[model samples]
Target: FGKENPLKANEWVRTFGATAGDPEGARLNLWAPAEARSAGGKSEIGYWGMELGRMLVESEQMPVCLINGAVGGTRIDQHQRNVADPEDVRTIYGRLLWRVRAAGLTHGIRAILWHQGENDQGADGPTGGFGYETYEKYFVSLAGDWKRDYPNVQRYYAFQIWPKSCAMGVNGSDNRLRDVQRRLPRLFSNLTVIATLGVKPPGGCHFPAAGYAQFAGYLHPLMRQQLYGHARTASEFPGLQRAYFVSQRRDEVVLEFDQPMQWSDSLMNQFFLAGQSGLVQSGAVEGNRVILKLREPAAGTSITYLDSARWNPENLLIGVNGLAALTFCDVPIDEQ
Candidate 1:
């Protein structure tokens, strides 16, 4: 079995056979074998797969089987098969399909979990400092390919990439990548960007065991509400909807959000306004909106939450569901 012309589905099944099926009931394969170490280890020490499986069994009375297919240090391009060369079995995407076919789960895929993009943001990355537009194109193409192959797959969830820190000072382009990931949901309705706010990666870009466990905790409730049609039991996470200049107070700007925010002294500190002079100034949170005091006028000023440029450990803006406000910026005040 090699990267190129790897084993086919039938061949894999004939050799390894189906990974022992879940005797409890049905199974939900949790793919991502490549990055298993990052999510814990072979036993899934701190992987979210364990948490997901347990939640499904206890809360929803559903049996699940996690099938991992992730490979470490791989870029999105590696996981994608060439649309023109669909028959090529060299790509990781082709290999993943083989695994799915071997498991006889061509139609059992509930959701696809993606936690990648670090490699793409590397200094000498394949894309060479890929921007948001380019990243969007590649991702959309990948999602389209996956859907074309597995029509039964319901939703696709991706993690916003971890940023550069003192421990791992490799790629400084992570913020750009994170921005691209944050806006992916707008482009693809079926995709959900799992918020990685408040998650502190240990050293390097990978989250430690505890961090992985915490990520699972964040994901469980979301899946419970989104996939199972259960009502949100926790506080909602605040997200920006739009921003505009106050007609009466031209120097002031109002920011609207999708959900209400739990305002606090610390939370208000996370909000910032920027203009040509840089870091304009922030005001107060009045009801479900935030007011920004522009240095001069609302001409070229923009408001951002959690300073989308760098990793700030102190940034905290809790939303409705006990989740932190997403990293956002570049909200034009003139736009309604």
Candidate 2:
């Protein structure tokens, strides 16, 4: 197996060196739903990770090791539950999430790979389990909660239910299942749904073997698309939405966005400050927009934001951008 190992080390540095690495690639962690570890045996889940990892090397990007977080026979609600779900390994997503949070690497999360729904397709008729509304409720909440949790994790949900290959009309004739798939992404800002309808629908519709992972050819490419899209969206981070009042009396700065934001370092990839004399000072984000106290008290400073179609947390303040001094946000782009 002589592969070029096509990507050279410094090439990444030379090309993307200007930008801050998303919290050191090698050290950044991934959390997903692999089955619970038993005393001596592995869960019956498939081995699609190796295939995924191999394809990644082909992409000219560094090979990233993924942490398995999926479990067997679990459904969608399982992944979104904030409370620990004992049916599947409890608090797994939460535990890894805490560490990622404590490490303060929100931006390090590029995307979440979700392959669920085998358990929910009881049927898809107007009266079937798929027709029920509970899945949608959980999905909508999950999107907001993930934003609330990581603030920087963009998700790519793979709707794993599908076009039944054998006996298409029976076992799991849930067309409504597909409808929900099409609908989930519209409710959240940073989510995308990978339509897996054409893939071989489970023959048993209840369980499938590890070789069933053949669908990765379709599923994995979609995963790549979503990950790249997340990066592009995040680069547009910290676009301000509103500036209610800038007072000269207390030298106070009061800002408001239709969406709420936390000032985390994840948001400050490479921020700068512009002084009145046309001199710009650069900064880093750990809490909020990095700013130096007005050296002259009245030196005066303003902020920056996207005047275009940026996700307006102002609409409801998506998540806080916890940052350090120097990075500033909510700089109102005049509404024209």
Instruction: State the lDDT at 248 in candidate 1.
Output: 50
125 in model 1: Cα distance from truth in Å?
A: 3.8
The estimated TM-scores of all candidates read: 0.75, 0.44
Collision count for each candidate, in order: 14, 45
- lDDT (10s digit) by residue, model 2, range 208-279: 333345444544555565664323222121223333223443132334432334443322222212223212
lDDT, candidate 1, at 36: 23
lDDT of 1 by residue, 155-181 (tens): 777876555422222433555566677
Misplaced by over 4 Å in model 1 are 1-46, 84-89, 165-173, 200-204, 234-236, 248-250, 266-282, 308-311
lDDT of 1 at 305: 58
